[model samples]
Target: MFIAFAGLPSSGKSSTARALGRIMEAETLLEPEESDWPLLVQERAVMGAFTALTWFRTVRVPKLFRAEDKRTQGGSVIVDSYYDVLIGDYLGKPAFNWLMPTNDPYFDAASAMVREDWNRLPKADVLVFLYLDEDTWMDFMKKRDRDFDRSAQLESHFEMQELMLQASRRAATEHHTKLLVIEQRSGSPEDTALRVRDRLEEFA
Candidate 1:
């Protein structure tokens, strides 16, 4: 199963994915440039551009990248991304938040880009949305130490978190796929992992 974990940056998606993989001894594939996206966005911001024409190069481009890279790797391939979000615009997020500058020109470009990626995603097996309350979200974001992130972004994240939760509700009804909102506060990694593990198996 291509288990994709989705949420805002620093919301513990990667942390949870890695932990789950370690516990299950599963294979995993990651968006290799994730660590650099924040810095890249900051670098582009100062120059007034996103420089994301490169996203056109998804590892699974052409919709036939490789089942083997995932399939033969192990128990299941877990991934972390801001994509796979349960929204009409999930595909446009990296662009909206990281690319387009909220102009007609940018909006038009983003629309085109969204349609393309929407075509690429398979009927995904499972989507896990990691949610934390406002205080917990801020705590985790601060701990990561990304200098460009600001309070305004956190406010915007607050909005997206609500929107994504709503989106998850819609997806559950529309697609009837598993849309688990595993809360990430309240305990240790091991504690949280067990709850997530139970949900994953129901879908897997």
Candidate 2:
């Protein structure tokens, strides 16, 4: 099974992916490192957001392809995030247009490119959403202390969270893929992994 773990920033999807990979002995592909993308160092400014949107589009497809390759070889694969979340982020309020004033033409062109990329990527067999309540989500973000995330307006963060969820649900429905939402908030990733494994079996 190819599984894509997804959630809001700092919601523990990556940690859970790592834990689940260990238990299932599956090959895991993490989100590409931001440090490797020079453009991302700009943070959440117009350049930063645009760079992030474009850069992830550039890299994540290849990562998804690699996961698909491993799955085709009869191995279970896990990915920490997927393109759906990227789309959500792009569509959020104060998105491209709001970030870059009077640049609808560029935004439109970029949107076209991202949509093209999204349409061609391999779909995950299961999309596991690590659902966190609003309070917990904000708490986790604070705990992580990512400067860029911390500095963002709270309202924008809330908007992005909703947009991401909408996108995830849309993807699941469009592809007829299994969508499992895990709402546990206090457990270690190991515990979360065990819960996820059990839940998947229930689906099976």
TM-score, per-candidate, Cα-based: 0.74, 0.84
**Candidate lDDT (C-alpha), each:** 0.59, 0.72
Give RMSD to native, each candidate: 4.1, 2.9
lDDT of 2 by residue, 1-204 (tens): 889987777888888999999999999888754356564544547454566566666666677888889889988999998754346335524632434333544666666665765576788889998888888777777776765564554425555555666677887888677888888586688999999999999877
Question: How far in Å is the alpha carbon of 61 misplaced in model 2?
Answer: 1.9
Clashes of 2: 0
Which window of ten consecutive residues has the lowest lDDT sum in model 1? Answer: 59-68
Best by lDDT: 2
Deviation (Å) of 203 in candidate 1: 3.9
Local lDDT at 31 for model 1 = 58
**lDDT per residue as tens, model 1, 142-165:** 776765456226445466676666
Q: Which 10 consecutive positions of candidate 2 have the poorest summed lDDT?
A: 95-104
